[model samples]
Target: MAIAAASTSSFPHLNHTLFPKCPSLSHHYHFRPLRVPFTVRASSAVVLERDSITQPQVTSKVELFACPVCFEPLIRKGPPGFNLPAIYRSGFKCATCNKTYSSKNIYLDLTITAGTKDYTESQPARTELFRSPLVSFLYERGWRQNFNRSGFPGPDEEFNMAQEFFKPSEGGVLVDVSCGSGLFSRKFAKSGTYSKVVALDFSENMLRQCYDFIKNDDTILATNLALVRADVSRLPFASGSIDAVHAGAALHCWPSPSNAIAEINRILRSGGVFVGTTFLRVSSTTPEILRPFIRQRVSQSYSYFTQEEIEDLCSTCGLINYTSKVQQSFIMFTAQKP
Candidate 1:
């Protein structure tokens, strides 16, 4: 839940405290459920790793853990006791802000549970919680601005990779699949590269976010855009209708990615483009070591794509021009339907 702006000065101290509490670090659970109150609004918010399957919000067993806001570390001791394993619950002294809340005391629930169908279904709930309040609050407070402001860092790199493999404008209809808040979609719309930028996603909240951002920006509005609410697995478009398809940080959440590719191929025109970027697999064989990042997302979960897998999927989808690269912890794969 902490952003990059949060200080990490106390990281060393925090690590010291954590190791002492759990001496058998390897055996200790990598993550425990915590209800993080992200906004000033008093509501339980979920906080988890960005790469694991276990979510913190949906679980019944919530524990207690407090991370210092200033240093973004769990306070080991505070106030009168600099060395005590304690938290300054009341308030904290800040050099710049007179006495401020240096810590946010929250829960770290560790309830026992089984991974059944019911347990797995909890993923959607976690995704919703993140998309609704977490992402919304981040957007409203300008957290997302930092993500895109510095010139859409990831997209340019991705597009550059695609360009190396194919011409910049094999232009026709482009579909920005799983376009969160429409940053990539707007980028394409503003690029003046395609005739239509079909901004699509399963989450209405996310699609709406993209819709609002695009409609307000004259550059994006200038280019034709159509928002479609449809799951990727069962795309509503006719076969071979789309010219290019690109999805940024959003393949893992599809539930059935292979089927989604089938649909993507179904809609993309012959000799069209299909581009994707995903996280490298975080180790599916060992869940215990990395099972607590929480929530299914394009960055985590089924998010990462292996090179062989990418080529295989492209080959299966009838895409001929297969090109891929690993950049900034992402597998950028570009293929063309021929």
Candidate 2:
């Protein structure tokens, strides 16, 4: 990518302390000093210097995040690198919408209603339950373990299965949609399989809980991982920019599964992969008589889908190569963007 160099006057918010002072130029005639900026671009880092005499200040430009409202690339100001600390200190702004998004506590808020104060909306019970602070704290501690009763196979096995499905997307960007408490996001980042991993969710407390688990782990913190607050139905990414999307046990909780899946397809590249896990309404072992009752009861809270329905949904959303593995109520499915 070409690096566009411009005068510091354009970005008035840039801290002068971040750069070094230029050497004095002495001449016979008295004239106004010209402040020229030099930028050195690299694959991993970008350095900006005010003058040749001073040391260049290294900073990283954020290009992965986009405006949730306008679907435009966000401009970033502040520190370099993709680490947690660098991202925390950075601020993102959308040029098209003239909207600014900043880090709330630790995670960046990129939702359409991120800055809204008077307009409060409530999500369905299934989505709002995870937003509670208490529930967010217990998600990985004990809540997720309950899935074993329904044949979840545990997190270690699930992570391995997802990894196998995501092999084609190696060295690419991965987004963990609805990543409550980031149980799988940390693993994906540590594996070094993807160039970057985004842990995205709508719950504020869930993101805070994710940061709590990551703050003490230097190994995972140093990876190219980002925590963002965004709605699943309206993903914040440019068209065909994402390589892989993983929603572990999250599809059933979405307000609208069709809208969410379509949004996922919109963000994925032509050959990108999407892997997700959710609870099926009724497994093969379920009694024929009880199937209807189970479906009715679950439909009141979460939108559990049958295996066939899931395949149909993926196909309808422009995804191909549909396949799945089922064990009792638990199901892991995969689809590719064509």
Candidate 3:
């Protein structure tokens, strides 16, 4: 029962969780799972080739990101290589305080800790299961399967809904918080709707998988896409600098959901939107037999929220125009900063 430690630095060494000591990377697994319903095809497709259709303009907007600890703008330093051209994507350091950060593959490591504090020791312990490259491999390979466990709209549908919710017009900056394997971020980047689609996650291995999927496949320019390793509780961005945020099925994983929500509210500009999905508490409509199973499945790391709780959290953050859809255990929400 070795739970996963949560996810690392530079050209800094990778923490164990991010790059767990695995036996080999030789194993191959199919990305699609076997049991998806007929109505839904595998949500993820082959990694498409990079196209310069919608790369973001990096030179004009480097001041968007701030140092997590010092709250100063971060400037690109050193050589370039993470997805974007050398001009836009490179190692980062604080402009004023002079603090520096590193990367694991394309993911710019920003958090001192790989993630926010784990809610319970067991929570991280269970996550340890993800440390193995094999586990990561399986998870990414079968993302659609795990995602479909609740039997709702698939990723493609959710992507469309998110586009409608955020309405990412030109020059908008959208951050995909806790983007696992770039499933949703890639779609947003390719759509060319937003000026930039940043894929931020704490797991180096997860980001590595994303880079592996996209590096040679697509022509997405460096300016349009970025990979950052950061904590949701402590995002590395200036206040009110972001236009929208998306976190799919990731809120329950945060140690401090309240803190994370507040941070999301903090970074969003007035009228900016936050759209994401999560698990909710068992509903009255749920069959009696399944309640125990669901309860047993929820570990300490994952906090199940009710519709009321979700709305409460959003309202407390001063977010308006809140809307959500609940079906059994799955919940999707969109809110706007006032």
Candidate 4:
């Protein structure tokens, strides 16, 4: 792969800080924009500078300003001040309204290149495949790609629940399992409510994405975010070693949620908190008709549990003082391990 020398401005070796000269054997990260037909690659940990054009370069910053639905910026209309190759300067599009962004904020990063085939998968034989497969859905939906998943009702509400649950709940410890990019976990990490913030995910790519978000000095020292890759049911830490456990949009992904829940109970200190969010079913409409179509588009999370079933599960596990609510299509729950 071609490499670039990140130089500061128009000077030669301006001697500015570069991303710590790469890290352990670097792995290429393949990323794809939603609704787009292409994938991009970032070679290893190479720092991308604005100068010293030594390698291929591109970025999603422009798309960030544009609408995903319409592929245009949400700002102002303009001929554009910056020049680009015909292919690179694709007009600005909005991610939500699909409108065009007509402002100066909509600039594109030219550091990214076409991604490799290694990170992609062959199309599933059947569209209903997502119903049974969890990881594949995550991999495709840009799990760690910063897609602003806050739009998902279930996941969004659960995040709100966790936000409130951990708030005012003084200093202790917290763990977020199957955390994708640790975005919601960042709430507690930023709240200063926990002594230790552990962000656990089964995918290293996910963890790398988390680091990408929390690598700044402020986060490292203030939140004390620790990245760990471990199964939800079988964590490497000792039993009862954790004080609080939180998960966002991860319940359905686990192969055996019961075991994971049980482990969560075991790991919490007598008053440690467990705040989590996961997808749940809202429309009881006939699954027969929508199931096949919906499942084909994306792995509809496991038929989300009803509020009653969730409460029952918590009760069966001996949880006390539980709080639950149904928002849109998600069931958000939190319980104390008394």
Candidate 5:
């Protein structure tokens, strides 16, 4: 039988007796199976080599999270699963850039500037307002209820409408962008409509509030729900990897709606759905004389868009089949990735 070429470097743990120093014999010479002792040694060496070859496969599962810097799929190490507990225990690292990400508090921080001590940056006032502990604490209490004045159909109705729009994306990954205090993210997880629901926000206090709400509910806590801290304009996921995106009462608060929508388009796969609700600059029934004044006042604080502008922005971002339901200053829009 022909002997396989084996290098000492390849099998450093093997005994040197396996390869006898015989100057007369070539390295590629055929070997005859003579002794049982030699066969046992060769067998053990082969077993070791096989184990070495297959060792990397043990931790080869790619995670849904990607490196914010390079956007490469992260390799997960630790307990496996998509639940909050498992993700919290696990550590993620990008093979391409070798950057590591882990749960800092109760949530995984995937923001571009996650770990800089001296380079902290402040966002616009609209975006930074939610980051305050006081605002985060009051978000679900009474602040959110104030949206009724703007004609936002209550959260229950809004959730139902969003669920209706999200039917096609059932049993897939759904990301709740700008999920302040996880009002709708908790509902999405409890509904069991998606295989995984990511409650993502840029505010640290908001994620803490989300975890606070989730910790008490075993049903939602045991589900495939994850709280992620990330910027909407620079979402931390692989391109074309997400199935659905929801932004509720969040468009006006983004620093740049166009950039945020474009990032949403980049993350969604073909046929994926995007649903969002926001305050419009002016409703169709608004008096023409008061329209400019309302626009000017709202523009100074938040970037509110009209119905036509919302549709135009969606189309310009490469999303198609745009549709909306407008009620006074509130508009809920849906679009699809082509």
Candidate 6:
């Protein structure tokens, strides 16, 4: 990675007073004046002055981002000029739509569903089922208990396989799709495997809880962890930009699994890995006693895949080297973009 030298004229005059270094987090951060005021673009470079000897070199990650609506690279909206650091921690408006998203407590808001018919006209029950405060509470609090009783993959093996599957990449950006309550996303951030981990969920309440869960934690810093509210079907990332992607126990909830998987493949780099676990449809071969519970879970699910169905789905999405493991009613799988 090349550090964009501050001498370039493409950067804006950064107001250092307004954008002070975040001291509370204890992470290496700094800012310097941009020589040439410029908007964020594919050719744009983020230049920051070194505030300390220990501060890591600045590199451009904006190229990894895109407008969900248009698939165009997003430009940051600054008062007079924009700084990438400011865009990361505080907030920045989208240059295209002038929509503002903030990182309140380091939780990045990426959803554009507000004021749309789907949000305003949808029944309260439909929306609340996923984004309600109460549902988020249950997911954050009682989900573990529910999992234990539901005969899903236990946390131990689930996380172990996640670590194993994603163990290849040492650093770079990794996205956690539908990261409910930020459980594994925060865990992966704490482990220091990736330079950054994006915790993306559709529910604002879920992301709010996710921010609360890690706001005070020392190991998980804003530099490495970002909570983004986004739909899995239409990911807001640049093509072939993401290093890896992961989702856990949330695939069944997707409205269109095929579209979501296609989007996942679209964002991942050619060699990037995609790993996740989800509910598998129970069959007649399953024990009679477990059928009712499985059916109950599947009833709420948009769709459930058997092992063969999932493998075929991955293949259709252009992911190769597919591998799957069945544990109880859960299916764990890993594949890579070829």
Candidate with best TM-score: 2
Q: Between prediction 3 and prediction 6, which has the larger lDDT? A: 6
- The sequence of per-residue lDDT tens digits that candidate 1 reaches over residues 1-338 is 33322122423333332333333322333212122221111113212222224323322111111221221212212211111112211122222222222221111111111112366323344235435745743553565445343223455665666544435435566777877666677777677677666676655567556645644455555465655444566554546667888887666556667887877887777777788766545333325555456333334334445556668987886777787665334567787777
Ten contiguous residues with the weakest lDDT in model 5: 39-48
lDDT of 4 by residue, 15-125 (tens): 111111222211212111112221222243211122225333333222112222332323211121122111112332222343322111111211111112356433222
lDDT of 1 at 232: 67
Ranking by lDDT: 2, 5, 6, 3, 1, 4
lDDT of 5 by residue, 1-338 (tens): 21232333233322222332333211322211112221101221111111334333222233678788888766554444577765664455555675666676668889988767799899999999999999999999999999998898999999999999998899999999999999999999999899899999999999999988887688988899999999999999999989999999999999999999999999999999999999988876899888767646356778888888899999999999999998989899999999
Root-mean-square deviation (CA) per prediction:
21.8, 8.6, 13.0, 17.8, 14.5, 6.5
- Residue runs of model 1 more than 4 Å from their true location after superposition: 1-133, 136-153, 163-169, 282-303
For candidate 2, the per-residue lDDT at 163 reads 97
Which residue pairs in candidate 2 collide?
Answer: 59-80, 60-80
Model 1, residue 304: C-alpha shift (Å): 3.2
Counted clashes in each candidate structure: 8, 2, 22, 32, 0, 2
lDDT digits (tens) for residues 1-338 of candidate 3: 21111111321322221222332321212111122111101111101111224433222324456789876666543222334433122335554564656554446678755333564323253334444566556666775567666744778988998889887434598999988778898988888788778898766677777777776654664447887877788898888889999998887777677888899999999889999788777764788787667645355556777677789998997889999877667788999988
lDDT of 6 at 95: 51
Give TM per candidate: 0.52, 0.84, 0.72, 0.51, 0.81, 0.75
Can you tell me which runs of candidate 2 are displaced by over 4 Å?
1-62, 287-299
Cα lDDT tens digits, model 6, 1-338, are 33332222322322322243445432533223223333333245322323335444343445345667766555443322122234443334345564444443344555556325545524224334778888887886776557654456566667778888876655867999988888888787877788778888888888778866876665664456667778888898878888889988877777778988999999998889999887778742588787556544456535676777789999999999999777666678999989
Higher-ranked by TM-score: 1 or 3: 3
